[model samples]
Target chain A: MNQLNSTQLETLRNDLKARGLSLFVLKDELLDHICCLIELEMEKGISFDEGRQIVFKNFNSAEMLRNQKKTKWIYQSKKFKRKFKSVLSAAAVIMLMMVGGVEAQETPDGHPIYGDCELASGFGIRRDPIYKIKRMHSGIDFKAKAGTPVVATADGTVLEAVSNPDGYGNKIIISHSGEYKTLFGHLSGFNVKTGDKVRKGDIIGYVGSSGRSSAPHLHYEILQGDKKINPELFISK
Target chain B: MYSKELMKGTLKTIVLKLLKEHEKMYGYEITQKVKDLTQDKIQLTEGALYPTLHKLESLGYVYTEKKEYNGRTRKYYLLTESGQAEATEKINEFAEFVLTMKFIFNSKLAAE
Candidate 1:
C-alpha cells in the first residue's frame, strides 16, 4: 500500500477537524480505507492529485461527522432530564381510557388517513443540520417540496399549532383515537390550528425548511401515548 | 472485471470467513481484511460493506457491541453461534467449488 506523505496526512487531519471529528477519535482503519482507495486509483493510471479529488467527491465528510455526533448524543441523551412533563401527563390520561375497556372507534378501512408514504429519513441516529450533533432523529422525514400540501396522517383533533422554542420551527401535533398522536414539524405554514377536527389526508400545512432543518422536508412522527414508535411500521410505504 | 452477479454470490461467504477468524471487527476493518487476504484482487467499497453488515445483523448472523476506542465509540460486530456454524459451512462449500473448477480447467489445458 502506498503510504500518504506527511503533508497529505496533515491536510486530511485538517479537513476532518473542520468536519467536527477530533484527532483523538480518528480511527487508523478508516484512514487506511481512504489511503487504499487513493492507491488503487493511482494504479489505474489516475494521478495522485486526481485520486485525491475523487476521494473527496465520493466520500461524504459531513455525513461521517454527523454519525460521530449521533454516537455522542445517544449516550448523553439517556441522562438529560425531560423538559416537557405535560406531554407525558396527557399520555397517562389516554392510557387510562384504554384500560377502562373503552374501545376507540376505528375509522373506516381501519387505516390512518394517509395510505401511501415514503421515508424521507428514518427515526434514529442522524446528523442534525443545525446543531451539527449526532442526535436522535426522533421522527421520520417525508419528501415534500416547498409549498407542497402536508396532510394529516390520521383522524385527530389538532392539539397544538403554536410556534414555540422547541426548535420544531412551525409545528403541529394532533391527538388521535386510542391515545395515539402524530407530530408534524418544520412546516412552512399551518392551515389547521388548535382544536380543529381533521380527517386523514386533510391538508394541514405546507412543507418548508423551518426550524433545525438543512433542507425542505416534512418531519412526521407517531407516538403511542408518549413513546415514539417506528412510523414506517404503521404507515404504508 | 468479475461479473457483478458472481461477486454477489460469494460476498456473504467471504465476509463470514473473515469474521470467523477475528473476535470482532468494524466496517473499515472488514473491508481492509478482504483486500489484504485477497492480495488486492478484491476490494469492498463503503456502499457495499454497510448494507451487507446491516443485513447480516438484522438476519441474526451478527451482533454489535459499542466500545470506546481511540476516544471514539465504535460499533464492533461479532458472529453469533449460528453465524459461526454458517461460516464453516460456507468456507467448505467455497473450497470444494474452487477445487472442482481448478481440476476441470487444468484437464482442459492438458487436452489442448
Candidate 2:
C-alpha cells in the first residue's frame, strides 16, 4: 500500500475537514478508498494540482455528500430503529418456533429481472444534464425512448402504474415476494396497472422525462423490505 | 514524492511525539502543528488524515473524545498506553534509520 508523506497527509487532512468529514467518524477502509482514487487520478496524467481539484470536485459535491450523509443517517434513523425492533421481534418468534421444532419457512428465489431498455444515467453526482444545481439522483436512469418498452426487473405484481406530479411523470411500483419491491419511474406511458401480475422482464411501461425530470429516462430502484440497497448491486453493468 | 512518502512512514512517530508533548489534538489542530513545525514543508490534507486517525483508533493506538466548539462538534484524538509504547519504539527506529543513512552517505562522500 502506498503511504502519504507528512506534508501530503496534512493536505489531505485539511481538505477532508473543509468538506465536513469528521476524521473521527471515518473508517480506515473508506479513507483508503479515497486515497486510492486520488492516487489513480494522479496516475491518469493529471498533475497533483489537477488531481486534488478533481478529487475534491468528486468528493465535495452535494449529491455525493448527501448520499453519504443519508447512508449515515439511515443507520441512526427512526426507521432503522423501528426495523431493528421488528427484526428482534421476528428473531424471538423464530427462536420459539425452533424450540418447538417447527421448520423455518423457505425464502423465495431472488433472480433479477432484466430491463428491456438501455442505461441513460447512473447513480452518482451528475449535473442534472438539465438543471444546474446538484440533485440527489436516488436511482439509475435508463433510456427507452418515449413509447419504447420498459420491463419489470423481477417477478412481481404491479402495485401501481399511474401518472403523478412527484416528477416521476408516469411511474410503476411492483411488489415481489419476500418484501422485495421494484420501482420504474419517469415513464411516458404505462402498459400495466395496479394488481397486475407481471412476469420477469415483462413490458410494463415506456420511458419519458416525466414529473421533475429534464429529459426522457426511466428511474429504477430495488428495495428489500423497506431498505433501499444500491440497485447497481443487482443490475448487470 | 519521495519526501512525502518518507514523511508518511514516520507519521505515527510525529503524531505520537506531538501528543506526548501536548497531550491531545483535534484533526485540524494536528495538521496545523505539523505544518508549523515543519516550517511549511509538510501539509496534511483532511482527506488523508482522518483515515489514519481512524486506523490508529481501530488498532487501539489512539482514542477520541468529542467536544463542542464554535457551535460545531469536534473530535479530539489522544494516544493510548499502547500508542505511547509504540511511539517510543518508532522514535528509536527512526533515529537508527537516520544515523545509518547519514553514516552511509558520509562514507560515500569521503570515498568520492
Candidate 3:
C-alpha cells in the first residue's frame, strides 16, 4: 500500500475539515477511509497530490454533511433509548407494586419537519422574540419560508386545529397516544381539521406568520402528559 | 449497479452480515468487500457506508477499537453478541424477502 507521508496526511485532514467534516464523530474513520482510497490510487502509479484530488472529487460535501448529521442523530437517539429504558425499568417496578400492571408505549422519534432546517430559537428561557423580555420559550423555532409544508411528527389525532391571531398564530395540536401531544404553531393554513387522524410525516399545515409577529418559521412543541419537553430530543434530520 | 432506492434499507444488514463473518473489519475494507462480492454491481459509497456503521455502533450492535497502522490510526468494527444475533435475524429476514420477491415474479411470469 502506498503510505501517505505526514505532510500529505495533514493536508488531507485540513481539506476535509475545511469541508465541514471536522465535527463529525466518525471524522477519524472517514479520514482513514479516504487515505486508504488515496493510497490505492497511488498504487495505480498516481502521485499523492493527484490521487488526493481524484479521491476528493468523489466526495460530495453536501451528502457527506448529511451523513454526519444522520450519524449524530442515530447516536443521540440510541443514547436517549438507553436512558429511557433504564427509567422505564424503574417505573415499571414501582407501577407493578402500585397497580399490578404496566402499559408500555413507544416513544416518538420523528424526522425534522424542514429536513435539517436552521434552528432560529430553541426551547427554554430566552428573550421573547416579540417583547425582548427574558421568558420561557415553549417550543423550538425553525426558520422556514412561508408556505413550507409542516408534517406531523408522529401518528395522532388532531385535537385543536384553529386559526387565531393571538399567541400561537394559526396553531394545531395533535394528541398522540401514551399521553403525548405535539403542537404546530404559526402555520399559514391547516391541511387537517379537529379529530382528523394523521400519520407520521403527513402534511398537516403550511408555515406562515399568521399569529405572532415574526418572520416565516415553524414553532414546534412536544408535550408528554401536561409538561412540555424539548422538541430537539425527538427530532432528527 | 442498482439504483439507490433498490439498495435502500439493505446497507445495515449487509454491514452487519459482513462483520459477523469477518469477525472484524474496517470501513474501507467493508466497502471493498461489498464491491468485490457484488462483482462491482453494487458500489457502497462513503456517504452511505460510514453513517450506517456509526448507527450500528450507537445501537450497540457493533463496537470499535482503534489500532495503530502504518503510522496512522485505523478503526476496526466487530459485532457484539447482540450484533451476532441481529446479523442472523437480518440475513434470515432478507433471504425470506428475496424468496417472496422471486415467488411473486415467477407467478407474474406464469400469468403472462
Candidate 4:
C-alpha cells in the first residue's frame, strides 16, 4: 500500500475541515478511509490527483456531516448517562428513554415496505384530505393501491389489529422494544392478529381506504409512548 | 451489492464480530474485509461505517488506539471485554432473525 505524503495528508485534512467535519474522531477515521481508497487506486497506476478525485467522488459531504452529528449525539448521550447514573430515578429514566429514542432513529433501519410509493401527506398539521380543513396529521400517508402489502417497520408484538367502519378502518399497532410503537392504519385486511410477534418487514396488512380515508393509502405513525412522531423519520428513503 | 437498507441494521454486528475474530482493525480494513467476506455483495460506505464505529466506542463496546505507520497515523479499533459479550448476543440475535425470516417465507409459500 502506498503511503500518503505529509503534504497530501494535509490537503485531505483541510478538505475535510472545510466540509464541516469538526469532530476530531470522525475526521481522523474519514481521513484514513479516504487515504486507503486513494492508495489502492494509486496501486492501479492512477496518479495521485486522479486517485483523490475518484475516492472523493464516493463521498457526499452532507451525508458525512450527518454521520458526524449522529456520532456526537450518541457520545453526548453516553456522557449524560454516566453523569446521571448515580441519581437516576423513574422520571429521569423516562427522560433518558425519550432522548435515546429520538437519537436512535437517525436512520430509517426498518422501512415499512419496498418499492416506490409517493408520499400523499406528511406528518404535522395539514389540510385534511377528506374534511378539507387543517388538522393534525398524526402519521404519513403513502399513496398505494388497494391490497398493497404493508409491512411492519420493526420487530414487535401486535398490540391491536381491529376493523372499524369509521376511523382508521382496519388498523394494526405493533409495540416494539425501547418504548416505541408503530401503527399501520387504513389497511384492507390483516395478516397478523393482536399478540402475534412480527419481525421487521413482515406483512401486517394490505393497503385500503378504510374509515375516514379519501383514497387508498397507507397511513403510518411512529409513537413514543402516547406521543406520535413523524413517520418519515423511520421510513428509509 | 446488497441494498443499503438491508445492510444498515447489520453493520454494527458485522463490525463487532470482525473485531472479536481479528483483535484489531482500522476503518479501511474493515470495509475491505466485509467486501471480501461477502464476495463484494455487501459494500459498506464510510458514511455508514464510521458512525457505527463511533457508536460502539461511545457505548464502551470498543476502543481505539492510534499508531504511526509510514508518514501518517492510523487508528485501530478492538473490542472491549463487554464488546465480546455483545458480539455473542448480536450474532445469536441475527441467527434467530434469519430463522424467523425463513419461516415467514416458507409459510407464505405454503399459503400460496
- Mind listing the fnat for each candidate? 0.02, 0.02, 0.67, 0.64
True-structure lDDT of candidate 3: 0.86
lDDT of 3 at A181: 90
Residue runs of model 4 more than 4 Å from their true location after superposition: A86-237
Better of 1 and 4 by TM-score: 4
Q: Tell me the docking grade of candidate 1.
A: incorrect
lDDT string for model 3 (A1-237, tens) is: 778888888898899889889754777888899899999999999899899889988877788889888888887888889999999999988888656321233245675364435789999999887899999998899888888888988788899999889988899999886678999998998999999998888999988887885788889998999899999898763
lDDT (C-alpha) at residue A100 in model 1 = 60
Off by over 4 Å in 3: A86-237
Give me the candidate number with maximum TM-score. 3
Candidate 1 per-residue C-alpha lDDT over A27-92 given as tens digits, one digit per residue, 9 for 90 to 100: 343554566567777788877778988987988766556545554453344334243345676788
Q: Candidate 4's error at B50, in angstroms?
A: 1.0
Residue-wise lDDT of candidate 4 within A98-159, one digit each (tens)? 78876554222576755557888899999887788999999888998888888888778899
Docking category for candidate 2? incorrect
Q: Residue pairs in steric clash, candidate 3?
A: A169-A211
* Rank ordering of all candidates by DockQ, starting from the highest: 3, 4, 1, 2
| Worst ten in a row by lDDT for model 4 chain B | B66-75
Query: Best by lDDT, which number?
Result: 3
Encode model 1's per-residue lDDT on B14-110: one tens digit a residue: 8888889999988778877888888887877654565466556656788888765433345677999999998999999999999999999999999
What local lDDT score does residue A101 receive in model 4, on the 0 to 100 scale? 73
Kindly list the per-residue Cα lDDT of model 2 for residues B1-112, writing each as its tens digit.
2375886687777777787777888766787788888888877655455546665765678888876442234577899999989878888898999999999999999999
Off by over 4 Å in 2: A1-24, A27-237
